[model samples]
Target: MLNRIIQQFGLQVQSINEVEDSHSSTVYKCTLSSGENVFLKIPYTKLKYQRELEAYEILKGRVSIPDMLEYWTGDEDCPGAFLLSELKGKPLTSKGSPTVAFQVGVLQAKMHTIHPPAEKVLNGIRNEYTNWSHFIENQFYSFAKDVEDVLPPQLYKRAIEKFEEMKHQLPPPDGPSFVHMDFRPANIIVDNNKVSGIIDFESVRFGSTEMDFTKLYRDFLCLDTTLYESYREGYNSIRTLIDLEEVLPFYQFTDAFNSIGWCKRRGMEKNALFLEENVSIIKNFIL
Candidate 1:
C-alpha cells in the first residue's frame, strides 16, 4: 500500500521511521524522493480519521496547521485512514529551552481568533450544561466522582461545596471561539524559539477560550511559573478579555481532578505522586 502511494505521488520512499505511537494513531516520518519530508498518520480506528479530517479541514489556512496533502478512507489497499502532510519542526521540549511556552501562548491566542460554525459551537456547550450551575454542579462533580477513590473525602467535599458556592460569582460564558480542547505542550511543535506548528486536533471543539487556556496553565505551568507568566503575556497581547484571577481557582481544581483521573487510568506511580501533590495545592487554595 505504501509502495502504491509513493508511486502515485511520483516520489521515492527512502526510509520510513516511526515517530510517535499512541493508542489512537501511529505517526511515521517518510523521506520522499525529492528529499522533501512528510509525515503519515495512520489511525487505529476508522472513526478517528473522520474527526481528524474534519478538524484539519476547518483549521487549514486559518492557522499554523499542517498542510494536508492527501486523506483516504478504508479500502482493500489500506484498511484505515491516513493523513499526509509536510512534517513540522521538532517539538519544543526537544530543544531543552523554556521559551517554547511563550510561543505556545502566542499560538493559542492566534488560534482562538478562528471562528468555527456558530450553531455547532452553541450546541456543543448546551449539550454539556443541564442548568444554570451546571458547570460546577454537573461538570466538576462528575469529574470528582471518577477520582473519588484516590482523593481525600473531606477535602474533596469542601472543594465541591466551595465551587458550588462560588458558581454564581462566575460571569456568563464568553463569546465562543475556536478552542483546541487539549492545548498541551505535547501538541505543539517549536523551532528556533518559535512555534513551527500545532497538531492533534482530535479534540477540537468550539467553546470558551478559557478551556484552552486552562489546559495550558495546568500542564505547562507545573514546570515553571515564569513560563506561565510568559504565556499569559503573549495571550493577553492578542486578546484582553480573559479574567485570569477568576478563572485561576477553577483551573486549579480541574487540573487536580484531571491529574488524578489520568494517574488512575495509566496506573503510573509518578502520576500518583503528581496527583497527591497537586491535590494538596488545590486544597491549600480552596481552604
Candidate 2:
C-alpha cells in the first residue's frame, strides 16, 4: 500500500506515519526523500473525499486551509485520497491559550463572510428558511425514536414539549453562509499561540453562524471562560456576532442528542452516559 501511494504520487518516500485522532479518514504523514513533508487523507467515504477536495478548492486563498498538492479518485485497487502541504501545528488542547481561541473566532468569522455555494450544502438544521420553529421541531421529531432509545422516556417527552414551546419564540436565522458546522477546538490547529490552519472540511455547509458557536458553548465555554469571551470578542470584530445566549442551548441539545444516538448505535455505553449527562445539563437551559 505504501509502495502504491509512493508510485502514485511519484515520490521517494522516506516514511509514512499514521496520524492519530482521524476517525473518518486514514491520515498519514509522509516524509519524502527530498525531506519535504506532506499529509495524505484517504477518506472512507467517496462523497466526503470529494467534498474535502472541493472545499479546499473554494477556500484555497480565502482561508487558512492547507495547500492541496494532489487529489486522486481511486479505483478498486486503492481508495480516494488527497495530499496537502504539511501544516505546522497541533490540535487545540483543553488549555489552549487565549490567543488561539481568539484567532479561532477571527478565522471562523472570516469563513462566515464567504457566500453560500450555488448548490445547497447538507446542514444539521433543516435548509428551509420560511419557519425556524418548524425547523427545530422537525429536527427533534426526526430524532424522537433515537432520543427515546437512549434516554428515559419521561425525560425525552418533557424535553420535546419544552423544545416545541420554545421553538415558536425563537427568532429566524439571519442568513445562510459558509459555516464550519463542526467548529470545535479539536478541528482547529495552533502553533505558538497562533492559528496555523483549520481542518476537517467534510462538515462545511451553509447555515446560521450561531450553529458554530454551539460548539464553543458545548466544548469550550466551561473549560475556559476566557476562551469563550476572547472568541466572542474576536468574532464581533469582523461581523455582527449572533446572540448565542439566545440560541446556544437549543443547538447544544441537538448536538448532544445526535451524539447519544451515535454512541448508542455503536454500543459505546460510557460515551452515551457522558452525552446523557450533557442532555441533562442542556435541559436546564430550556426549562
Candidate 3:
C-alpha cells in the first residue's frame, strides 16, 4: 500500500520503518527520494483516521505540527487512509533535558492562544463539569471500578467519600483554553535539545490550560518541588501567573488511575512497587 502511495505521489521511497505502535494505529517513517521524510499514521479504525486528519487540518501551520500531505480511505481495493506529514524530531522521552522541557512549555503556552470555533468549544464542554472539584469527583467515580484492585481498599473508599463531601469546597474552572488533553512527554518531539514538534492529537479539546500542565506535573515533575517550579518558570516565560492549587488534586487523582491503566495495558506489573507509590501519593495528597 505504501509503495502504491509513493508511486502515485511520483516520489521514490528510500526506506520505511515502523516508528511506534499504539492501540489505535501504527506510525511509520518514510524517507522520500527528495531527502524529506514523512510520518505516516495508519489506524485500525476509520473513525480514528478521520479524527486524526481533522486534527491535523485544524492545527496545520497554526502550530508546529506535521504537515498533512494526503489522506484517502483504505478499502478492499485501497486498504486504509494514509496520513503523510514531514517527519519531525525524536520524542522527548528519548532526549530528556531541561532545555527541551522549557521549549515544550513555551510551545504549549502558544497553543493555548488558539481558541477553537466557539460552537465546537461549547459543545465539547456542554456535559463536562466546569468546576474543578466536580471534575475530579466525576473522573474518579467513573474509573473507580477499574482501579479498585490497584489501590488500598480503605484509601480508595475514603478518597471517593472525601471527594463527595468536598465537592462544593473547590474553585470554579479558569478561563477555557485550548488543551492538548494528553500533553505528556511521549507526545512531544525534541531535536538538538529543543522541542521541534508535538504529536498525538487524539484528545485535543477545549478546556483549562491546567489539563495540559497536569501532564507535565505528573510525568516530568512527579512531586519534585524544584522541577515543578522550573517548569512553571519556563511556562511563565510565555504566559502569565498560573495558580495550580485547584488542579493539583485533580492531577493526583487522574495520574493514579492513568498509571494503573498504562501498567495494565503494557503488562508491566513487575513495577507494582512504583504503582504502590502512586497510590500512596493519592491517599496522602489527593484524599
Candidate 4:
C-alpha cells in the first residue's frame, strides 16, 4: 500500500529499508531512482500524521528539521506517508559534550521563537495549549488517573495531594513559545560534534518553554554541571534563562508521573527500570 503511495507520487524508489525508531510509525530509509535518499514514514494514527505534517510545514528552513519533500494523507486504500529528505546524521547516544549541548540549547531557544499556528488557523491540534496552568492541571490529573493502578496506593494518594499543593506555584512562562514536547538526546541528531537535526515532531505543541526542558534535564542536563551551565549559556545567548530552580522540580515531578502512567499503559515489565526510576522521582516529591 505504501509502495502504491510512492508510485502515486511518481517517485521511483530504488529501495526501502526499515528504520526502527518510532513506536507509532513504520519508518523507512528509501533511495530514490534519482540517487537521492529520503524517509518514508507512515504513522499509525491520523492524528500523529497531521501533527507531524503540520510541524514540518511550519518548521521548514527555520530550524534543522528533516525536509518534507512530499506527503500524502492515506485514504481507505492505504495510510499516509511522509517522503522526507534524509537528515544526515544519527541520533545522539551519550550525554553529549559541552559544545553539543550548547548548540542544542541555542537551537531550542531559537525554536521557541516560532509561535504555533493560531487556534483559528489550526482547528484540532490537541497540543495548542492556551492556558499554561490549565495544560499542566489537565495533564497532572489525567496522568494521575492513569497511574493509580501503577503506583503504590500510598504514593498515589500523596501524588494527588502533592500536585494540588504544587499547582499554585506553577510559574508563568515567557509567552506561548513553540515547544518540541519530547526534546531529548534520542530525538537529536549530531554530526562532527554539532547538532545536525532535530526529529520527532508528533508531540510538538504550543506551550511553556520550560516544559521542553524537563526531558532535556532528565536525559542530558543532570549528567554534568559543566554541560548544564554550557546549555544555560547557549540559551541565554538568545534569551534570558528562566529560574530553573523554581520551575524544574514541579515539571520534573509531573514528568515522572507521566512516565509511570506511560510505562503502565505500554507494559510495566519491559520498562521496569524506567518505571522504577520515575517512581523514585515521585517518592522524592511526595516523601
Candidate 5:
C-alpha cells in the first residue's frame, strides 16, 4: 500500500523513520531521493483523514502549520495517507513551563482568528456543526456510551447533570472559529524556546474558543500562577483573551470526563494510570 503511494507520487525515498504513533494516525519522517524531508501520515480512520484534510486547508496561510504536499484517498486494500512538508522542531513535553504555556496561548489566539472556510474550500465534511455546543453535546453523549459500564452510578449521574447544567451556559466565540480540540504541550513544536509549529489537526473543529483552552490550562498553564498570567499576556498580545473565570470550569470538568471515555475505548487496564487520574479529576469537579 505504501509502495503504491510512493510510486504514484514519484517520491524517491532514501530513508524512512517512524516518528509518532497514536490511536488516530501512524506518522513517519521520510527523506526523499533529493535529500529533502517530508512526513507521511496514515490515519487510523476515514473521519480523521477528512477532518485533518479540511483543517490544513483552513490553516495553511493563517498560521505556522505543515504544508500539505500530497495525499491519497486509498481504497479498501489501501488506507489513506498524507505527504506533508516537514516543520522542524522538538515537541514540548507534557510538563509545560511558563515559556511553553505563553507560546501556546499566543498560537491558540492566532488560530481563533481563522473562521470557517468558504464552502468552496471544503470537501464533503460530515462533521460540520451549526453551533459549538451541539458539537460538544454530541461528543458527550458518544463518550458517555463508551464509559457507561465503568464510571460509578452516582458520579456518572452527576457528570451528566453537570454537563447539562453548564453546557448551555457557555458562549460561542464572537465568530465561528477553528479550534484545535486536542491541543496540548506535546502537540506544540518549539525551536529555541519559540513555537515553530502546531501539529495534529485530526481533532480540529469549529467550536467555542474557550473550549480550546481546557487541556492547555489543565496540563500546563494552571501549574503555576506565573505561568497562567504569562499565558494570558501572550494571548492578549494577539487578540483579547476571553474571560475564562466564568466558563473554564465547565470545560475542565467535561474534558476530564471525556478522558475517561478515551481510556475505555483504548483499553482501561493498559491506560489505568491515566484512567485513575481522570477519575480523580472528575471527583474534584463534582466535589
Candidate 6:
C-alpha cells in the first residue's frame, strides 16, 4: 500500500521509517529516491482525516504549517493517508531555553488574528459556543462528571461550587479566533531558536485565546518565569494584553480537571495524583 502511494507521488521510495504508531494514527518518515524526506500520516479513522485535511486547506499561507503533498481515502490501491513535506526541525524538548516560548507566543498571536468566514471554517465542538463563559461552565461540569469516580469527592464538590460562582464573574466573551486547541511544545517543531512549524491540527477550531494559552502556562511557566513572561510580552506586541491575573488560575483549574479525567481513563494513577494536587492548589485560591 505504501509503495502504491509513493508511486502516486511520482517518487521512488528509498526507505521508510515508522516514527509513530498509536491507536489513532500511524506516521512514517519516508526517504525518497531523490533523498528528500517526507512524512506520511495514516489516520485510523475517516473523521480524523477530514479534520486534518480541512486544517491544511485553510491554514496554508497564514501559518507555518506543513505543506500537504497528497491526501487519499482508502481504496483498492491505496489506504487512507496524507503526505507532507518534512519540516526541518526537531520536536521541542524541555531542555531548550524559555526564549522559544516568546516565539511561540508571537506565532499564536498571528494565528489568532486570522478570522476566516464562518462558512469557511468547519463546525467544531468547541467553536459552536459564542459565549465563552457558557463553554467553560459546561466543560467544567462535564469534566467533573467524567472524573467523579477518580477524583476525591470533597475536592470535586468544592471545584464545581467555586466554578459556579466564578462563572458569573467571567468577562464578556472575547471575539472568536482561529485557535490551536492543542497548543503544546510537543506539537511544535523548532530550529535555531525559532518555531519552524506547528503540527497536529486535528484539534484546530474557532475559540477563545484562553484555550491555547492554558497549555503554555500550565506546562512552561513552572520551568522558568521568563517562559510565561516572554510569551506574554510577545503576544501583547500583536494583540491586546490578556488579563493573566483573571485567566491563568481559572484555566489552570480547567486544565487540571481535564488532565485528571484523562489520567484516570488511562489508568495513570501517579499523573492523576499530580493533577489532583494542582487541583487542590487551585481550590485554595478560590477559598
lDDT (Cα, tens digit) per residue for candidate 6, span 189-233: 899787897887766666777667777665665578777788778
- The list of candidate 1 runs beyond 4 A from truth reads 1-24, 31-36, 42-48, 75-80, 94-103, 118-142, 219-233, 268-277
Q: Candidate 1, residues 92-122: lDDT per residue as tens digits?
A: 5633345666667677888787665544433
Once model 3 is optimally superposed onto the true structure by TM-score, how far is the C-alpha of residue 254 displaced, in angstroms? 2.1
Each prediction's TM-score versus the true structure: 0.74, 0.84, 0.75, 0.90, 0.89, 0.82
Residue pair clashes in candidate 3:
74-79, 74-80, 75-79
User: For residues 155-191, could you state the per-residue lDDT of candidate 4 as single tens digits?
Assistant: 8988888888887887666657778888988888898
Global Cα RMSD, each model:
4.7, 3.5, 4.3, 2.3, 2.4, 3.6
lDDT score, candidate 2: 0.73
Cα lDDT of model 5 by residue, 1-287, tens digit: 66777786678899988885355788888899899999888887887888888878778788888889988887886667899997787786655567866887788889988776565555524333465566778888899987677888998998899889887786654446777887877778887667887989887766567778887777777778888998898889899988988778888888888889999999999999989999998888787
State candidate 4's TM-score. Answer: 0.90
Question: Could you give candidate 3's per-residue lDDT for residues 1-287 as a string of tens digits?
Answer: 66665565566778889875344577778787788788667676655665566567667777788767777667664535565675356666623666666676677777777665554433222223255455556656666766676666887777666656554544565446667767877777777776777787655555566556766676775545655666667778877636777766656666666566455544646757756766676667554
Model 1, residue 64: distance off in Å is 0.1
TM-score result, candidate 2:
0.84
Assess the local accuracy of residue 258 in candidate 2 as a C-alpha lDDT between 0 and 100.
Answer: 60
Task: Name the best candidate (by lDDT).
Answer: 4
Better of 1 and 4 by lDDT: 4
lDDT of each: 0.65, 0.73, 0.64, 0.82, 0.80, 0.71
lDDT of 2 by residue, 1-287 (tens): 65676678787788889998675678898888899989888887766776677678667798898888888888785657787887788887787877777888888888888765566453332334345446556656776767687667777777677666665555668567676767877778888788998888766655566667777566776587887888878888888888887877667767776666556654666465666676776566555
Q: Estimate the overall C-alpha local distance difference test score of candidate 4.
A: 0.82
- Candidate 4 stretches with Cα past 4 Å from truth are 9-15, 31-35, 77-79, 117-120, 124-129
Question: Residue 275's C-alpha lDDT in candidate 3?
Answer: 66
